[model samples]
Target: MSSNRNDLDRARAAWRWRGQQRPDFAVTPGPGQESVWDYPRPPAYVPDSRHVSVYAGDTLLADTHCAMRVLETGSPPTFYLPPESVDMAQLTPSDRRTFCEWKGRAEYFHVTDSSGRRIDNALWRYPDAFDDAAPIAGWFACYPSQLRCFVDGEAVRAQAGGYYGGWITDELVGPFKGEPGTGHW
Candidate 1:
């Protein structure tokens, strides 16, 4: 386990874009917009007071004016809603688990709508987050691809792939990391 952890640490250290410099392909943010490239590598836990909401079809799954945005370089922000704002009954633990060197292990959840429609692994949380990521310990982040998500009344577009959970709002500009051929980014 220690060997695997060390290997993960090494891989995390090897990332090319750590937000010190933006790649040529990165989009420059217009007035109120933010460039994902400007975010940090270890990610910043930004407290966002904007109204964020998630819906599984027509059923509301989560809603909050207080949320945390995990801002990482090369990716759009992933909004994490506090547990108190989420409808816990709609989520069930999923078998899928993933590790983030910066945040520690993440556990997935399957979100189900009132109509019984289920979106597997539609949400995730870091129950035992690393020291730096401790603020989001019980917060949940949903995939916009699997559910409808909004930030301050603006609809969110899912970051270009199935794996990444970044929520792209109109105020954010990016040649985000999850797109095809961007595996190296």
Candidate 2:
């Protein structure tokens, strides 16, 4: 109980530092678009049936029709695919781990292609997700900038900062939070 309270306090402090208001420069959603600012806090995990694909240059690493997307306020969506759809041969477990107050501990993976080129800590997964984030258990998500990603046949662009692994697409409009000076979204 005390640990949970401490965790909640830390999360609240982080959010306070990141501010709560949407920036004025944030794009207004037009037809068929989503403004990231409209997303929910604590994030939402929802099923996405779109065909999602990942590639390391020309090597196809993952392709799946079943995926989950995490939508959080001020950030672009991060899509996660089931492990079965991914080429497990291409991934090597990394010692890196990160914590999320809403989820739990996240483990990272290093991706490598057939050509032997490697992207360190390019993938992440919450092996032990919190009850509310259980939907993402056993799923994996990658950094679009490290490996090419496509959603419904459209190529994805990586969100600005190296820390956040959100994939930016035409349907997502933003003056996104991961960019410079947005530490206080």
Candidate 3:
């Protein structure tokens, strides 16, 4: 007799097989492909069926239900989702830029409330990512102070400690791959 584990695996395999047929819109670049001097990135996004993520600071902050992608731009790998996942009224642009070899250049934004509280530049987006990863042209990342993280409507903490801005998922394994490990990976 086969266990439910086999049934689950079959279902997952079927789903994954179906997904590969479609062209991936995300413009994610493979490692070492980025020009550290030029710094432009287009990325390949791994699709997340469980797309709703949020960051709340004692309030109802960002919330959305769509596909999610991880940006590998030599900075911090950030969680990027469709803009519709977040309420536009609560966000604003911030004057911050981080340099990345893989993803090109990045710009940041902050969230605010009706009460006039500022969240600072807790979010970011790559306006024009590099060649391999361009589908995520406008999605943003939430910095540590601006919001807490949640995926698939579940409240989750960043696996990466002290990574206020960078969002962590099953795919983008780090803390050992990059800094904190002194770039050994």
Candidate 4:
């Protein structure tokens, strides 16, 4: 309802505050490494076959062998999993929604465990992605900070700052966008 929308708006405003200097956390990408600074502006979706899994403490919430990774400038890669690979029964639709210029409207989901523990609005998806991002339609992406997210058995560090959901791992180098003073990046 309006309250949820307002909350979502407030959250976005807090995270998207403008002003900054791009920091120097970007490292020279070595063999088998990717520098987030080198990512493209409109973002690019690359099919990823690496196994992806999400857990709420000891409870398995999602597991997938197929995923799509979005690489955007100044941000770590974000992996999107097909809905079939997630435990849809444990997720309830949330009233919150957000707009992504390239991805269209993103609907939020609250994750819950059978025991009733829940993480509010921690997952999201673009039911109708813009043409440039259509590859991710019907896919879901989680905030690693809200749950344990893994790629090929490696736990991913959550991208700092709550607004953008990107997965950070040894394979990537930053100053990523979510950190302090990166609003303008």
- Candidate with top TM-score is 1
C-alpha TM-scores of all predictions: 0.95, 0.91, 0.60, 0.85
- Residue 97 of model 2 has an lDDT of 89
After TM-score superposition, the amount by which residue 135's alpha carbon in candidate 1 deviates from its true location, in angstroms, is 1.0
* Predicted structure with the largest lDDT when compared to the true one: 1
**Model 3: lDDT of residue 174:** 28
- Stretches of candidate 2 exceeding 4 Å from the true structure: 1-4, 16-23
* lDDT tens readout by residue for model 1, 32-93: 99999999988999999999989999999999999999999999999999999999999899
Error of 3 at 80 (Å): 0.6
Per-candidate count of clashing residue pairs (backbone under 3 Å) = 0, 0, 25, 3
What overall lDDT, based on C-alpha atoms, would model 3 receive against the true structure? 0.52
lDDT of 3 by residue, 58-155 (tens): 56666556655554333334567677677777877777776444455688777876577787776777788755457666776675435767665545
RMSD, each candidate, Å? 1.4, 2.6, 15.6, 5.5
Which digits, one per residue and each the tens of the lDDT, describe model 4 over residues 1-185? 23255654554355331223333555678899888877776678999999899997778999988999998878899999998999998899999998876577899999997679989998999998878889998899999999999999999999999999999999987778877878757
| Comparing 1 and 2 on TM-score, the stronger one | 1
- Candidate 2 has its poorest 10 consecutive residues by lDDT at 12-21
User: Tens digit of lDDT per residue, candidate 2, span 1-185?
Assistant: 12286866766467632315556777788999998887877788989999999998789999999999999888889999999999999999999988777777889999899889988999999997888899998799999989999999999999988989999999988878887888846
Query: Which whole-number lDDT from 0 to 100 does residue 134 have in model 3?
Result: 73
Model 1 stretches astray by more than 4 angstroms = 1-5
lDDT of each: 0.90, 0.86, 0.52, 0.83
lDDT of 4 at 20: 38
